[model samples]
Target: MSGFVAGGPPPSGQTSPDGHINTSPFWPSIDLDALRGTLRLDNSISPPRLETAVIAAAISVNRELAAWRIEQQAAGYSKLEEVPGETVKGVPEQVHLYRRAIEAATGAEVCERYRSYDTTNSGGKKADDIAPNIDDYRRDLRWAIRDFLGTTRTTVELI
Candidate 1:
C-alpha cells in the first residue's frame, strides 16, 4: 500500500484492486495477431518489421485512450472496458475500435484533417481555414470518449 499513489492511473498491465483505474494496457498483449488479421503485408516487408510497427502503434493508442478511461472512472463509470485476458476483463466493446485505429495508423499515417497555423495565401485561402474531415475510426473513438464522459458538450452565451 505504501507504494500506491492515489487519484491517478493504475500501473501498466493491471487495474487497481478497487477498480479505480482499469485503463492499463492489456498484459501479455500481442498486437501482431490483430494486425495480421487487419493488414495484408507484402513479401517485401518482413514479419518483424510489421510486428514492431503494430506494437508501437498499439502502445501509442493505448496510452492515448487511457486518459479517456481515467476520465470515465472519475465520472463514476467504472466500466470503461478493454480486452480481456487471463484474470482480467475490461471494456470489450472498445477493443475493436482501438484495434481498427491501430490498423488504420499502421497502414498509413492519419493526417490532420486541417492544416496547422498558417497565414493567408496569395489566392486568399489559408491552411486550417476549413473544417477537418476526421476518419470514421477516429470519429468513433472521439464519440466514444465523449459518451463515456457521460455529458454532451454544451455552449454557453454570455451577455
Candidate 2:
C-alpha cells in the first residue's frame, strides 16, 4: 500500500515538481497488506480461541493507533485544525471500522460476559470487570481455544 500522504500544500521550504509551490510531501509507504496479514493471523488461529484473541488484539491495535494520533496532533498535524468547516483527521473513522469488525466477530460471547459482569457489579458488589482484565481475559481466551480445539493444552506458542 501507499504511505501516508499529508494532505495540504507542501512544506514551506520544499519546491513542487513544476518549480512552483510544493504540493505535498510523499509520506513513507505503509504495508497495509502486511498489517492485515498479521492481524488476520491473530484472528485465524484456533477458532475457539478467536473471541479472546480478537478482542485483545483489537484493543492493543486501537491503543497504538490512538497514541500515534496524539503524537501527530502534537506535531501540528491537521488533527485539530478544521479544513473548510470539516474535520481533517481520519483516525476516528479507522477506529470505528476496527471496532465494528471486532464486535461483529465476537459480539455474542463478549455480550454474555459483559452482562454477567454487569449484573454482578450492580448489587453494590465489587466484581472484576472482564473487559479490562487482560490476563484473565487471555486465560479465558486460552480456555476457549482449548475447548474449540478439543485439547487440554495450556500454552500456545505462536512463532
Candidate 3:
C-alpha cells in the first residue's frame, strides 16, 4: 500500500506542535458550539450583555472549582489524619495554596464588582480604598467554602 492515504496523509503523517498525532480517527465534538451561532445575530441588542453573561459564567465556574479543590483537600487530610497519631501539617499549606489560587483566579471579579458599585454611588474611588474590604470578603468566602467542603479546621490565615 502507498504511504499516503487516498484522501490525505497517513494516520501518523506528522505530529502537531504539542507533540501529539495530528490525525484523529474520530471527530471531536464541542458542547459550546451553539454559542458561536449566537454571535452571528443582528445588532439589535448590545454586545456587552453577552460579554457580561460570559464573565458571570466564568466567575461561577471559578468559585465551583475552588470549592471542589477544598473538598478534595479536606478528604485527603481526613484520610491522612485517620491513621492513629498521624499529624497532617501540610493541610494548612494546601489550604493556603487553594485560597491563593482562588484569589488569583477571582480577584478581577471582586475588583470589577467593587469598582462598578463605587463608580455608580461615589464620583471616583481608587482601588486602594476598596481593597481592604475586597480582601476581607475574599477571606470570608474562602473560609465559608472550605468549611462547606468538610474542613473542620477553622483557623485560616489571610495573607
Candidate 4:
C-alpha cells in the first residue's frame, strides 16, 4: 500500500489534542476540539495552520467589534459573554455567535490558503470548487458578527 491512502486519517501528532485557546480577558476562550469538529475539519489541516488561522480570525473578529466592546464596557458589561442575549442550554447566545464568526472566518482563511498551497491540476480543480465557499464563509462571518452586535444583516438603501 502507498504511504498515503485516500481518506485515511492523518498520522498521529499532526494536530493537537483537545485543548483551549485563550482569548482576551473580555472574551471566552475557544475550544480547539470543538472548532475542528464543528467545522468538520479533517486531519489534513495541520495543527500550526489551524491555530494560526483561528488566531487570525479571533484577532479580526475582536478588531471588528472593538468599538462596540468599548461601548458595552462603558455600559457596565465587561465581557462579550455578559451581553444580553438568549441562552442555549445555559450558554449565552452571544458566545455561540462569537464562535460562529471565528469558525466562518477560519474557514475562509483555510480555503484561501489552500488555494495557494498547490498548483497541480487536481489542486486547481479543488480550488475552483471551493472558490464560492470562500465567499459564503465570509458572508457567514459577517452575519455572525452582525448578530453579535445586535444589528441587522442587511441594510437596503435606496439608490
| Every model: Cα RMSD to truth | 15.2, 20.1, 18.2, 4.6
TM-score preference between candidates 2 and 3, better one: 3
| Candidate 4 TM-score to native | 0.86
**Quick one: best TM-score, which candidate?**
4
> Please, what are the lDDT tens digits per residue for candidate 1 over residues 3-89?
111233323433222321122434224444344444443332334455545555566666766777666567766553432322215
| Candidate 4, backbone clash total | 0
The local distance difference test score of each candidate is: 0.43, 0.35, 0.37, 0.81
Candidate 1's error at 71, in angstroms? 3.5
Candidate 3 clashing pairs? none
Between candidates 3 and 4, the TM-score winner: 4
Q: Which stretches of candidate 4 lie over 4 Å from their true place?
A: 1-11
Query: Which numbered prediction scores highest in lDDT against the true structure?
Result: 4
C-alpha TM-score for every candidate: 0.41, 0.21, 0.28, 0.86
Clashing pairs in 1: 81-90, 81-91, 82-90, 82-91
lDDT winner, 1 or 2: 1
Window of ten residues with lowest summed lDDT in model 1? 1-10
Per-residue CA lDDT of candidate 2, range 2-56, in tens? 1112233333433222331111121122222232242332222223243353445
Q: Cα lDDT of model 3 overall?
A: 0.37
